[model samples]
Target: MAAARSATLSHLISTNEPPSLFEVAQLRRCVQTLVPRARLLWAEYKGLEERLQLCRIVLSPTRRLPAEILIEIFSWADKKTLLSISLVCRSWNASFNVVSSKSLSTTTMRFISEDGIPCHKILSWLAKPVTGTKTLNIEHEVSYREIRCKCFKPANPCPWAAPDFLNLLAKNPTPAQMVLRLKFSSPNCLSRLVGGAGNSLLWNSLETLHLQLTGNWSGRASIYRNALDGLPKTLRNLRLKINNPKDRRQPPPIEVPEAPFNTLKSLGIECSWDSPLILSILRLCVDLDVLIVDESIGRHTWTESAAQVTLPKVHTLRVKCLYLHESEKIFPLLHLPALASLTIDGGEVPFADRNWVLARSLRPLGLLSPMPRICLRTLVVQSINGLDGDALWDIFSHLRFLRCLVLQRVPFEGAGFLENYRRRTEGGEHLLPALRMFELRDLDEKFDATSFLCFVKVHRHATTRRHEGGHERIQEDAPDGLRHISLRYGDCKESRKFEAVREELVSMVGALERDFGVVVQMTRG
Candidate 1:
């Protein structure tokens, strides 16, 4: 009977039909008798898990960053980046402040002045320790608007800008390259700046200084003199302007005082060479190896005393002569025994024009018998209108030691000379026998491309091949013909599919490389 009763209870528990009132009462009694502590423990465990999750939310990665570091991150963001950050959330927008450098050497800092901010403040930012800047260029000619800004209350915005700049150099870590370009400034600032130059820290570290002084030069020699005197001996390269005195009545300074810059290796004078100031500076540069003289418009001719300079150590000479006939006269004055490279650019009027003949350009070297030919191995002539075949030969024939020749901006009219030269290549007369590299730039399509191939064919690899003859042996020892020919021209030389001449030129260039191990490069402008 008891087993039957237990079976009936099991059936009732398993069945899905509605339980009777008696059965419900029985279930309730069973639940009331269950273990109370077990239920209590499960509820406690769930509560703890929820609290642990809340702790994790509080310790998120972003919350770990320190306050100062976060500010720095915001500071580094540029205006655009900051705006984007601001759009992301109100918090970031509120924190956005200013952005602020690390061997700033070789890196250029471009500072555009604004109305409210002073230039001194801008310079201070440049001198910041983290900048490590080795090159600094301050230019006032940014834009027309900046010049006309209204924040500058004084009649002169920065009349003292030049002097203040000098002061900044003294205080900041001296940079390797410093260029100051100002406009319409008084000479008095130069005087005041140099007066305090002894205190400038730049004297010890500055290697190259380029100063362009734009103003009237009346009787301001004392200011210029004082400034030039402050230049330290450590300066190796200098580019300065020493304009001729406005008063022609004032003769050249009776005694030229030599600046104490014996270590200078290069000097570029943008002043009138006629100024005694320039000549005296040259005398001080005993070790100057490279000299570039850029003449001002006032005067082209130099007095006899100013012209004569014996720069024996100078191996490279580059002069911009405005006058056509002045170069020849200038050469007698420069007894450059060690001159190995020469670059001459004829202003406006191409040197290849009728008046400026190749022979006339060289008249200065004194190409007579006992007077040895200029031992220039490298020569560069640019902006030549036209050089006839004979003129080109005259220039090349004298340069026995010629190794590299660069002709730039040479018009197509002159380029035909190369064809004439090849047709009349005299027997055993090797023009440019030692030539190793030839570069012709800025040529149009009219240029004789065929002459270039012929020149290479005759000259290439001829240097190493020994010919059994008296003076011919020397030519063999001379370096082989042109090793490199770089041609840079415009649209005319562009390769076309059906152009036979262009295709032939391409084939010729390829053959030279394959057969003679030469490098022929063609670049389109």
Candidate 2:
């Protein structure tokens, strides 16, 4: 009888008529008793499903694939997906690490402090030997918030707050190239590397060193001098960048070393202020092959003795001056007898600062005169404020060997600037007669596209003109003509009218490429 009663209670809800209050209470009690058990069973079922999926993955046929095939497959994935794949299993992570290590020779590790504590990842990564790293870049940044945090007490300061990488670096093989970018609130943070005797031996195998010092420079001149003195003399290429913010305090006197860097092959300097100390350093690099000078201000005056320092072997020279007056100081000073490539960048003037200075002129570049038969094959000029096309043509007239010309954001004073190119096809001696590569970007709004088309037609006929005049032209002397042409227009109000002639430009470029074997790339705004 009890068994029958239990069976009837189980089927209490099977009846069509609604249950009475007592029957409904009995049903509620039954459900409450089974709820916890149902939850436990569902969780167990989910665990089993996960284990089954894992078993399938472990027994997959793809696991037998060769490392080369796996590497090729991984190469097709983006960085984010590849990283996720690396985290899936230990074997996959090891394989991906091998592939990545063989592909990249340069590795950059950045250390950012939080509440006066060093990053644990960097510390652990340093604990192991970093094999196959040709160039190691270490950037240490200390934020003011971290230094001023409540947890940062001077008496009980963090031991790893300041960078001390000597012990860590000794574990790895000596790298050929090292780049140190340091930004700190106090100068004492550099004590480990700068104030130690192991400084010279630390970089014994270094051939290239790029040091960028940026931070509070209230009294940093001496520290900078010491840092330079401590560097290894075996460096062949050295680049120094001084990113000092504007300060109201009196500028500290900088004393540069009198010793020359006789082994240096290339030297580059970028600074915000004018300093005679830079000239002193340039005078020392007598065997420099390439020189780059980029300065932002023209306030300091250079003495006559320090003005004309000649670099006899320099074949490539790049000068970037933000102010118009800076050109007067830079051009007349450099005498490059073997100059092959010259780049003059007149930096852009912000819209807000345009009121202070109207435009920077390229007329100063003309000051580098009497250069020994300009072997200049490449000339790049961009973002000049007030450029005169006629005067610029006069500058190009001298570069008989100019083969590649790149001009960008150069606002000309008058229209028909390209008319000068026609003179080359009309007759005798002309400007840029050997130009084989021409690139123009962000052309002026008022520039006439019809004139440009005419120029291209003349350029196409340039070499034939040289053969015409019944004069026996040497086979080697014949110009290559314009073989590569690249034109890009920006999307702005000034370029809308230029877009109207896009169809005509495309047709002309296509004909040039098909008929003359010229490489042409043209993009409409």
Candidate 3:
């Protein structure tokens, strides 16, 4: 055996033969003789090289992008793709946080024609707050768990109990803003949140608090009042809307949350203008800066408390109603000296003349006096009966700095503002002395074209201001020069019928362009 191995070792006859255990034992002993520290260093070097190569192949260039850029890139991605990217890692999860983070704004929602949806399921799901979410909007149609309402079945009253809301509030106490709009099938509804139970995080730190109730509001007035009072007092904006389908014959007592609405800066209420709730809120929200009233005057007889309410800081007031009679009543209470923008619209209300209200209520306020306190810039008025010319004059006389004027569905009566300006010229004072943009709409064949022409001529001249310091120095915004006059005639057929009148209007427009360098347009309303 020794002689045969000797021959194999020398490769004298080693074809188809394997090495013996003695050869393997010698190789093992050689490896065992290496230095321990050298082996460890070699192992580490190989491991690190492998890791670097793996990183080179798998690491994404997108990972090096800044978070803001990454977010923008992800924003353009589809929803499913965005979700997939979010699950990549914790940092990426945070980078593309869309609905999951503070970028989500407070929104309003409404669901119409919805049948039996499990209110508890929805409330429970919403109550499980989306982390870092800012506002939760439950627009409409919430119901109880396991209970279905077939809206098609008239026999099923689908009366949802109040306890479901309690369960939702109990489970998911909101830490951010939540817009709650409730419409109940019956007179009964959830009364209030649990008296003293909530997350440590205050819910009132929200940017806005909106509550709208549209069912049998009268029957559940106390319930709503309790809910509102129990709400947090840290809201910055509040919008309350109530719609009652029942006749105004037996109006219920107005109920709103008792305040120290200390943080509320903006308030919009769509209840009756004479609602006690509105008065109560006004008395509480002293720091309000924006107020919009879109309500009709109810049967509220002014009591002693009504005289004390005042909104001191409101600058923008927009009144939208079908009737101006309520506005007439509202104007007396709103002695807003700081008012800058006023919009009043009598939308589809018969016998609603907003100009009459303005003339009646504003005249005594020393409005448009030689030295006026209110510096109004924008005025928008709309009505059906057409504004009385004297009424328009009375309102315009009070405005010296008015820049934009929009009149809708209101015709010019008597002598126009320019005609009045021409007659009552005392030291270069023109009608709407600083007017820039004049927009009128929905004038029928009965509209006075001559009055409109006069309006354009006067406003174009007034738009160019002269300075005593320089020779013919125009105003800073003189380039516009009353070029933004837009008029819409309600009846295109009428304009076609009165071809001569249409040509006359076109001639006037052409004259404006040629002489004053102003562009005027007429369109069908």
Candidate 4:
């Protein structure tokens, strides 16, 4: 047997013939087995090099500088640079602390690692007392384990229920504003963090709160019910956003607060809410000065007995998404007596639905009613489809006090709107006489630039002649002229036509700017 093995080894060592496939496979397997070990060695080598570089930095003569000089250098550095340099050595960390302690007005706490590991260091640091922090932002993003374990489905509590953080918040001077963003893993998680049972005085002095709640919260409206139970009276501005999950489960309704949030002056909602919840919230905001509704105003149905909500003090109202199917129910529910600025953004419409005019949906209710004559000063309408010439005239003729007008993606018929406007101005009518600024953006292929320029010339000529005799010829209520005019349109069909008439448009706009002192900004694709 020994002689056979020797013969085999000698043949394998000195054979001229190519090896079999089995031998090739064995060799590949051996190479694969060493890959991880090689990686480990490379990592160790890199670590050693880093440590040697750190040693060199420590032994350099720069380390011998006085603490006062170091403190001055640290003071000049920004927050990110100071943090990076603090990791070099203990003395640098000490210097950074000295600078940070004096100028730390904002503190942000991120309590979890990205890949699902618990940040034990941050958890331990949360136990220390923090003072003089005017703004505190705490955010916990979704973790890998939470995704892999499907923790959003089960009622399992997240591990980072830091009671110590709540205690620290209570110990410090009350922050003027606090922003909290977290996922609702379980009710207990929020109960221990900021709920009523967490700390009684946590929000006593807070004036502004921006709360963003996100999760697969299809059947968990109770989470919001418990979370918003104990708001501070000093909160004057509240921005709430709930990122809705893609599901069809109609979550159970949450109860509205018995008492109103009378101190809230500005409210912005960025998500869809049930009708009852939205109505309740608006009813409480009596002093709301600015209101922004980014998403749908209401998601569910409303009964016949649902009363209209009156926001008497809302001066600036922005309705970002106006679905034609739902606009009828939405517009009649609000009565804003003091509305001054309005933005109606009708987001992209399908090709098949090009004839749905907004005039049909804008009923004579709320601020659109003509009897009392809403003193709307600024009007912005964008991305609207099927707004014909007559409907456009109907909407614009009522705004006698409009100072700024912006229209985009409005495909009016031929030159109808502009012709009517010019004839009215020439006939000594007072429609939009107070207009000071007009902006047109992203016009469709149906736009008639020649007609528009004619209107502009007529309007400018009329207004410039108002003070020709060194005295005001027009009414005192009307403005002198249009101070600013911006025309921008870009699309496939319009781009071709724009190139054909680009030079003429530029020359005309320049003359308007030079003669009337009007700021004309014109661009075409």
At residue 59, candidate 2 shows an lDDT of: 95
Supply candidate 1's per-residue lDDT for 333.
Answer: 61
Candidate order (lDDT): 4, 2, 1, 3
lDDT of 1 by residue, 151-203 (tens): 12224344334455556657765543453332223333444445555567764
- The residue-level lDDT of candidate 3 at 326 comes to 49
Model 4 score (lDDT): 0.63
Which wins on TM-score, candidate 1 or candidate 4? 1
Model 2: ten consecutive residues of lowest lDDT: 147-156
Model 3 per-residue lDDT tens digits across residues 100-166: 4533444333433244335554544454545554454554454554222232233433323234443
Q: What is the lDDT of candidate 3?
A: 0.59
Where does candidate 3 have its weakest 10-residue lDDT segment? Answer: 185-194
Which ranges in model 1 have alpha carbons more than 4 Å from their true place? Answer: 1-118, 124-135, 138-167, 176-188, 220-227, 245-257, 273-277, 296-308, 324-329, 350-361, 366-373, 412-419, 422-424, 461-470, 473-477, 491-502
lDDT of 4 by residue, 405-450 (tens): 9887766443676677766767666456578898888864446766
Q: Supply the global lDDT for candidate 2.
A: 0.60
TM-score of each: 0.65, 0.64, 0.57, 0.60
RMSD of each: 13.5, 11.5, 16.5, 17.1
Ranking 1 against 2 by TM-score, winner? 1
Winning model by TM-score: 1
Q: What are the clash counts of all predictions, listed in order?
A: 0, 0, 3, 0
